[model samples]
Target: MADNHLGEFLRARRAALRPDEVGMVAYGVRRVAGLRREEVAVLAGVNADYYARLEQGRERRPSAQVLDALGRALRLDADAQAHLHRLAGTAPALPLGHTTDRVSPALRRLLDGHPGSPAYVVNRTLDVLAANALAETLHSPFEELDNLARMTFLDPAGRLFYTRWNWTAQAVVGHLREAAGHDPDSPRLGELVRTLSAHSADFTRLWNTHTVRGKTQEAKHFLHPDVGPLTLTYLALDVRDSPGQQLVVYQADPTGPDAEALTLLGALTRSAAL
Candidate 1:
């Protein structure tokens, strides 16, 4: 089947929007949930047929102005708008194929430096390439910390570990969506999505939303079995040497209870090793 990511994205965004949200008044019984094709065309200042064609995959090349107009019509945020451009071929897509999963030694050393903090590296697909001692200990509850998405939805411990599972799930899907924009043709990503969709209804729901996000910076709350509750702020930085790898560092204030919990967690890890 011909992949129509652009069309799927447009349709998903359109269905997610409401007429009243865009200052459009409903005239009659609408068959669909969101604005009609004609309505979007009117708002975007493009011909209705042209808009329809774009959504139907008939019109592959859309000008930047038209894309900008469509973005406005869909109420796309900066990330979603960038995704739209990438889908439309207006922006440079990310490097294709599987990005190297190996973490460089220097990067490993950086992760080691954060003994008090939990630091790990993940690829674009959210695979845990490498993690420091504290980082591994933080996610030790999971059966496997290989892939964040899989562990989140597939693993039973995911729900128990993450205090805010819904928010975390949304962020995971958004990150995957952003990755999709980069490599729409990636088989590895395709298989992951397929497996996730097959097994996880929540994954299916959020995947359909077509929301785009990256694992940039966020505060994560975890309920560790050994250490109790922990709230940590994490920063995700893209590794300059590796195209798709990201170094994520989780930190808690030294004076805070969360930091104490982290300390205990680290001690527990050491005890287990011993």
Candidate 2:
């Protein structure tokens, strides 16, 4: 796999954009995918050789102004722009030991209070650090649901559980890629990546795409064996004072069938616990 993450990301992002998408007219029989390196250099107002050097990993430490121009030229979204800055080494790196997997007492209490919604906490490596009863019930299909990436890629039941398996897989991989960039030396993250890369070809393919994305809000589709199909919206909140931990909560429309199924599932889970 390509270890030059900055170069890899730049190449991927550049390949994802087209000339017409950026208001450039396409000539007949274009050979390259997306915009050419020279085209990007012209659009970003930099010399073509300099931009080539940037992609070749020979030139690092691009100025803020140049990064901004490149961000615009690439037509990057807010998240992608932030990722570009991080790859360019413009963003401040978090010091080692600053991140923790521990969930606070207050956060645990908050998760317990959300009986109607499925809530859980995950660290940077997507390890299930803490989870409420409903969350556990929701993910009960997986034999080992401790890590989100493992469940998404390695588990046989993942395809059955996730109605949109491809989307879920991509999201999981993208989130992990973003986390890896943030904390490259994380032992847990490295181990997980190595294990998945060895076992799962899909995981290896997605990991090489060099996509970086953080989960914020997204509609999820789950086909629970007990509850049937469910359409839920999830919100992932960054836990305060916990650098690597995220509190994710899932909910369905109050008047929908999913909501009714969730209620039944909660009751069943609570009764089973007794």
Candidate 3:
């Protein structure tokens, strides 16, 4: 519902950092959360009023240098820095409908080859465009599997499916925020955000944080109804031909219990499909 998302992001990031983390001494009882607006301005080597204006949406377009400085001051990682640039209107926008939900045949072949692992493809907006049998089995417990963001927040089973629900929720929201920055005018994305914001308070809270991050390599813990508890490492690979599509593969250590469970689950899935 809020339109000044860039400002909201800046404000949230500023509120997340503490004075001590930025090498500033805290002498008095702080009245505000995280670093004050003045503190961020000082750390980034910018005027306080100017930074204030940036957060207030009065200054929509910030120079690249300022954005870089702000990124540094906030201790943002590479993805977050890129996201900051996008929010500040310094990054190039994706052409409307740049991302397609259609999965390529080559990608499908790749997914088919990875029978031992759960492999799926998602677009910028976290839409599950394509999935292998293992991947489908992996997410079979969910009522809806089309959109990862929606399932992560809106579904009642999401909390149980993701062992670390809070972390996954935050990561999903951050990824969506990053996507929004690149494709600001996406109708589907706008609709998804509005829908999630209205349905889930937790989604709304995390969304308000404006954190941005790409889905990279991570260890994910899942409590699959069929597989029991499993821990798998996932890799997110960009589909070079499809600009905004990512091929994600999840695999458990070959000698581990999770791998055995996954094998059993695969067999079960095959039987069910037949």
In order, what lDDT does every prediction score? 0.89, 0.87, 0.88
Quality of model 3 by C-alpha lDDT: 0.88
Which TM-score value belongs to model 2? 0.92
Put the candidates in lDDT order, highest first: 1, 3, 2
Task: List the candidates' TM-scores in order.
Answer: 0.96, 0.92, 0.92
- lDDT-wise, the better of 1 and 2 is 1
> Which candidate should be chosen as best, given lDDT against the real structure?
1
The candidate maximizing TM-score is 1
Query: What root-mean-square deviation over C-alphas does model 1 reach?
Result: 1.4
lDDT of 2 by residue, 25-143 (tens): 87777675788888899999999999998899888889979989998998877777778887777988677678888889999999999888999999988999999989999999999
Candidate order by decreasing TM-score: 1, 3, 2
Residue pairs clashing, model 3: none
Flag clash pairs in model 2. Answer: none
Error of 3 at 153 (Å): 1.5
lDDT of 1 by residue, 1-274 (tens): 4788999999999999999999999889889889899999999999999999888998889999999999999999999999999888899744554468888999999889868788899987898999988888888899877999999999999999999999999999998999888888777789999999999999999999999986666789999888899999988898977888899988888899988898898887678778
Between candidates 1 and 2, which one is better according to TM-score?
Answer: 1
Residue-pair clashes per prediction, in order, are 0, 0, 0
